[model samples]
Target: MGMKVRGISYYDYMLLLFVGGVIVLSFPANLLRVWGVPFFRGPYYDVIFVIFVVLALCNLWMSKDSPLPSYYFAATLLLFSTMVFAIGVIRGNENVIAGMKYFALPLIVYMLLVGRRFVLSFYSSNFLWSLVVGSHVFCLLFYYAFLYGRVYPGIGVPSISFAALFFLAKQKYFLLSVSLLVVLLEGKRSLLLALLITMVFMRMVRLSVVGRLIYTILGIGILVLSMYLGLSFLAGITGSAIVNRINLLNPFSGSFDILLGSSGRAGELLSYFRGKDTLELLIGSGSGFTYEWQLGYASTQEGEIKGYFHMTPANYLAAGGLLGLVPFVWMMLLPFRAGALKESNDTRTVAFGLGVFCVVQSFFGFNLATDAVSIIFIIGPMMLLSEQRRPGGATALRSNSLERTS
Candidate 1:
């Protein structure tokens, strides 16, 4: 247990570096621009990304055994991604390589978190608490920026995952309340909805009738208060009457419209292959081909906007076609499998909830653009694999063969 860095026993140093990378990546890029901090710009983020990738590769090579099924599945997915990238390269899709860098770099971090021993040395309650605190700091910073009418690009998925982990730890619900408020203010309706579902599920499974009753009452009160406060802030910004702003917050106001629109989009995505040749339909337009197929944001740097399919399955199908879609789908599901195999009941609950949340979110959000979110979605549940063995730990096979011989 004498984990050392230089002369100091700094086993947690890897954890510190990982958190630092998250913090650096989550820094308000807009502020850097306003301050003319060229040194803290894009390449700074890339440097940290490169460092983690190198570290992950090193750890992977040195790892004696894979800790989790998600690790193996994720590695397989990464290989499939590489094959897709190779397809793009062969076809001379010149920018495919550049576009994939953003998608691939975060994945390296995901791999490191799951597969690296140093990072996973003590992924217990204390580790979860550290993540929760870091997430709260992240949430607070993002909210303050929003209050000032400055929208900085950052991910709330980590905050949401941390909140889920907090519940799994059976802590007082104070942090959950704060997390909900921050997410509401951030206006990520999908994640907010997922949080609501997760809370309901957690309450049903973990709380008694009386506890659930109290939770329900408190949750309703919090929901109403959050809506009121959120609308008031928006009213202040838009100079709209308070009453009118409240109307805009109506839960049912656009439900039907959204459902219809989403359905229509899903239909369109599914039918996109109608006129394509069999080869194109099976192999896709090519990896990163969505760049030519979709729209880009005006403010995003030229060539930086990864195309969006608005649906996860569609995105994969369009990018990798059938060839790339299978492993991607399996990768998404492996979290649930990993969770189911966990010994802890709470781990199973959280892993399944987070897995469902991520799957649902993918229906509405773009994957490549939300790299931070995707990382949490993949690795959050994957943490459950820390205690698992590789399918009877090398002796089961011998035992089975012996039985067969008999």
Candidate 2:
């Protein structure tokens, strides 16, 4: 028999440790820069990437199972990466390595997860709950100790959002509230939107077919109205920065123009395709391609910078063109595969909700491809899918369920 620790197999325990390390190290390095902490930068991510790739290869070597749908998802990402790299070569882009790594990171993680024959149940594991709570505690201490309670985007928002979804599915209302509060403090609008969408998905999945159709029709109008009233209330009490962001939704104030102007997405898109030939448009300028955009006063002395677009659609289209965009969309939709959705079990539903959260967040600026925090979103659901395919997997999952606390 395999060695076990506290009833978990040695390999499963190692997986948990790997996930915990990723969570700790995945905080935005830019935030640390403000405090003069330079340790958590590019090389740290490279180390994690190397570790994950090695684990994936080992798992693949040990497993003898047939290919699953998640494997196809990984393959698609690989294909997208290959296409981007080839186009980069043709264009002789010198920054291809930098661009290709973004796409490759997700591919390797997905492969690592899909290769696993067994995975711990995220819903019932006490270890996961403790890990999440511990991370949040550490975040709070760090904020108070180092940053003097200053709030900025990317203070573990992705990991906290994932924790929130897990807690919500488990009906751990208190922990969910804490997670949401942390996310709000981090000040990421995308994470808030994702949480709302995932909550709706969780509720919808439990209803009957007809009930879901009716709920969908009614829910849209209610959701919009509630959001308007809620945001309006929040604007009154929140900081000016958040209030300014909320004001971008006001159509009466020409919010669309303000948004487009502020984000520079429209200008970026126009600049990207203005002079491209048909063939170039079809396959893109490759991964390392960059465009010049005006910068805010705080950014640089030159008043402009050259970089990739922040918007996912714009970035992917520029890097891989139409050929790359299709697969990116497919990879995002992998969580909704029929087999994963057919069962409404708590574990499956929670995994599904996290998947939805990531997909929704991807549109705004969440780089599912490059962000290390995205590992949970891919791993959780894909592991469930793998379990579903294994014989007696459902029973095994049921047995793994145990009471957990904050």
Candidate 3:
């Protein structure tokens, strides 16, 4: 029995190891919270979502010889929303309009890869990795230095994440390193800590001797650099200060318990978005909410709150209203696309890597909710698990030959 376990193929084990990547990556993403009505909000939330959707679709067409529905994951999410709407209806959340809005085009389709052809397709694999790395870098750069005269870098559509996704794909250590440092120096204490835990855990579990050596050197280098930056760039912050800031999100006894347990922001959102004098608030305002709800479009009021959102659920509410939100509740319950990857070498590794990244990033961000971004984040993995697949091979199940777009 022990020998049998050992005999599991590297690809299969790789598939399993993929989960580690997902856990490490997802903590920084955003939300899809549903209350009396469905609403969402955040900084750069839409940018992340759009990017996720686009990658998912690209992955769908990229997937080879698979009969998966490509749309099953998204459809399932939409269907789940319907069920949740039933609950809202019963409770008379008066948010049925909010719940039902998600059905418009509530389907996600993933790419299907054929055989081991893509297993070692270095170009494609590295391309995707580059996208991840570049996005990470761009985001960090945006957070720290700003870009193209924009206060927020990735906020621009023809911006960093987009530029890197298809064009400049590969593992960019420079960008990655910069991100690590920036997150540390900036006050995003939660993100830095989460990433540290994730990196250490991965090293402990699967990093090879060479990888570990490289990583140890890398870690020491980063710490030393951070110390320099702390003294030069961020004079006020200390190691203890960094640790304390990160602790706010830790769920620890002293610092964590009373966490967002500090409800000023939460209370404000409820009052501003969910309070009584709503015109179409129940059904939701429109198909995308930003800062300004009294006025259409994603803008916010002038002053301190400008460019920021008070109501968190504004994204969903804006896109579909309760009328559309109903079709997406419990949407994530579907196994991540990795669970549906076929038993093969190249497909398994690529699927696992992509799936894990999407899951981790989406959880921490919210790119999973955008149409373009959701392509890779939510549906790309599903491409491997669509209804096109069955007990037998997809070739055997083909009725009409169709070239699905990658």
Candidate 4:
């Protein structure tokens, strides 16, 4: 039997610690920086990640489970990273280390989780719910008590879209409501859109094939109508910063420039591809690629800022071109493969929902492969998927042993 502590398995606590550490370190690290904490530095976060990885490796080493999925994922990431590194070397990129860190960290986290055997039971779900909700509560308190009504996007919490979907899939309405409220108060357009889409999706997926078709048609019409009417209504509202920001998106203005100009992403995308030659366009400029783009929307400073694109497509295109983009897209769509969505179990459903949310939100600025904390949310579900694929649904012996000890 696995070791137990206070009626809970040591392995379960380790997983909890891993998840909690990411939640604390990712967005809340910003809070630490504001408070002048030295531990907010990159090395500290790296240390936590390293510890978790080492622990996971040890567990995998002791287990009798097949490691084929882990090997395949690691190989794929190695190939991609190698290509990016080679291109960076050839192009003499100075920020290759930073670029590779951003590109490889999430993939490594995913690989580690997918390679392991873990059970997502009631205890796991409750632990995740409490941890995520507790973090949001603390962030909300800090936002109101310290920031004095100023909205700092992602200030104290990483993207909660995956958690929100998981809660919704499990019919944990209270947790789902709390997650939605947190996202709504955060006032991130992309995140709000992603959560809303997830809510709609969970509802639609429960319907029959014909019902889903009808729902989609009706949803599109209602969504369009709502956008048209809501934008106009919201534009006239006063004293709300989020509404004021929403007012800027005037889709009826008959000009793409007006709509896309607000985010400056259009300008960034254009500048990214403007001068690329055929070969450079095919394979990209590699990691650490930077381009000059006007950042008029920025609050702190405005002008030409040289850095990576905020959009995932632009980032992937600039880093790995079609080779990177195709695989990235395929990875995002993996949760939708045959038998994935057919799982009747709530835990598996949560995983399926998270995969869908990740795909939808990728278009809006979330990058699972780049954000370490955000990627942690997908790990459990993906591992569950891997387990389900095995003949006779191989049980997670570690988790079972731990349960027995408990």
Candidate 5:
């Protein structure tokens, strides 16, 4: 299965698939509708999901052993997630399938990646670097398109920027600068704060003194250059008023309001918590059952659009209750635990940082629950899981030995 095409290995192909799929799939479906394009219409909406699933199943079938941790925490998390899915099926929540497409698909893809018997070791510099470059290019496209009006990217911008930064920091500073510009342009205060958190974390754990100093200068340069670039386009495209709308000082305040807002799950969570019995608080309404489809007030060319509040944790808690929520939170931590088992400190830190970034981003957007951003979530942690296996672990040991001698 690890055959080469010309010179490129099957491992490289899968890496490409993971990176490319995330970028292409992140394009707003609403953009296609706005243009009335028949592209990717109908049953093809899940194309990205299908690609990952097929690849995952192939890898899983061929895999000699499981990549899953045998720890009690890992067991507890998986069991809870399974119970949530089963309850959703029992409750006849049609959207459970959609949730599977988003959530479960990534989980499968991640396991396949971390396992042996398919693809290269995740520790391969080639694989890691390619992912970094690919993500940086996507971030460039995201901002450049927004600047020139080719697409309307939204909410998850800061998370995407920082994720790229995690990879870029060790490789290329220029790409990181460009990505920082994109995050600035996209203008989500919550995500911006998340980016800051990631940067601070990286500075504390990952970077050497020289690396930190370089980044500090690069960050200042990026800020100055981005301002010039943005101001030049202020009147025509980069809309300065949008920046005014950003309450940078009050980033988390809005999240609190959303929790208290009538339009969202805040009230529902309260009612469910105050239930007459304890089991009701324990089980939740069932997966994908909390939110209902409703008409949106914003009228598009297709008429009044319809959707639901997908504020992930709240919705998941409302649906799966604590039964679903606890496991979901644990699953988020599993990557870090897996990474902790890796001997390479840098690799472990990067994997854990990626996990932190994803978890933080989830609060403002459903990036972890959506196919596009799930790619980011899946690749980083699974790469760490790959480290615990054979050839990959061997390579890491060699590198560690060389470093000790040096």
Candidate 6:
């Protein structure tokens, strides 16, 4: 592991150390099940969850030679959050705690992974690509089965076969088609839309002509398959009535027409914040409001069954508040910018899309600590492979420098 980057060779055991920590955390998160920690938890089966966290850490630590962004943004965000929590404490407001979940994701990821080489590591590129596609396939299939009433106790359908098809079936039109099916079938339009937009954007603005053509053909096939399956899934779940209530997914649903319903919650906050010229839009939302808002926030008043799962970007605003989220958001775009500024290939393109996907996924149904690491996060970052030649000046794999983190 000894390699000189910017004249530093301390990377010798960083990867091992990181992997070891992950292995320890991973076991508790997976094996101990109900006993490990609070905010994060999962069944004994979620090895992927713990593995990714480790990967993210290792990716950063290993990439020690690369200078990451100044931590000002992340630091400020944490500061704002801490101050808000402090205020909430004095007033005994609980809503500030509600911000915990929303605030945790990027903070933890950035605090651990940012400014690290693993993110751009060539060794992790391939792993990340596999991670994104594989996790989506699993979530997509499981969700499809659930909607169709086909989900039993275990993996439904031929997961292995589906996985093969998933990787091999990459096509623009096909991806779009399949994405639409997944949206309707799983009733998770956010993820479906994220994939669709990503694939289309990649094809039009990012990929080569040959890649686009291949992706298009596959896209068509996936569309047809999705249509067939999605219809059946809907039929098994809610029947034609799903069509009637589909409009409710808009967030400004029928239920939000009245006072403080999810729709009007914003109006409430805006009204509350109105006439406040002295407020810091760039820094924080004051305390005591967390309890008043969350236990009582409009995301709930809107009649949402799961108030915390609001699809609005407003959640980002309200939960972590402004100051806390700014740098986190910026840090998120760091990789995409790096890819664009630096010459990259399909792997970097794919990573860009997945990073966007994870961002979008957060706005919807995901939890703070599902007790597992999300597959998208893992494979998305792990997929980069080595691009440099071997040491001793040889060009063979592993014989030379091996991979480089993108």
Per-candidate count of clashing residue pairs (backbone under 3 Å): 0, 0, 79, 0, 0, 50
Q: Which tens-of-lDDT digit does each residue in 222-296 have in candidate 2?
A: 878888788666545444655556455544333325434235445555555667788877878887886655433
Least well predicted 10-residue stretch by lDDT in candidate 2: 294-303
In model 3, the Cα lDDT at residue 227 comes to 47
Model 3 segments more than 4 A misplaced: 1-124, 127-268, 272-330, 343-366, 387-406
In the range 202-288, model 5's lDDT, one tens digit per residue, is: 433345667758876776677657655654444243234344334222233232244322233343334334433666556865555
Model 6: residues >4 Å from true position, as ranges?
1-69, 95-101, 114-184, 203-312, 319-325, 328-332, 341-343, 362-406
RMSD per prediction, one decimal? 9.8, 4.2, 13.5, 4.7, 8.2, 9.8
* Tens-digit lDDT string for candidate 3 (200-287): 3222213456775888687768766664554344433345745554443444324552314322233334434644345455554333
- C-alpha local distance difference test of each model: 0.50, 0.63, 0.37, 0.60, 0.49, 0.40
Output the lDDT of residue 120, model 3: 22
lDDT of 3 at 241: 48
The weakest ten consecutive residues by lDDT in model 6 span 153-162
Off by over 4 Å in 2: 1-9, 24-34, 64-71, 117-120, 144-156, 208-210, 234-241, 248-275, 295-307, 338-344, 373-376, 379-383, 396-406
What's the lDDT for residue 354 in model 5?
56
Best by TM-score: 2
Return model 3's CA RMSD, one decimal.
Answer: 13.5
Q: What is the lDDT of candidate 3?
A: 0.37
Which tens-of-lDDT digit does each residue in 76-113 have in candidate 6?
65675576566546646556555453444444455354
Which lDDT value does model 3 have at 36?
14
RMSD of 2: 4.2
- How does candidate 5 score on lDDT? 0.49
* Best candidate, lDDT: 2
Quick one: ranking by TM-score, best first?
2, 4, 5, 1, 6, 3
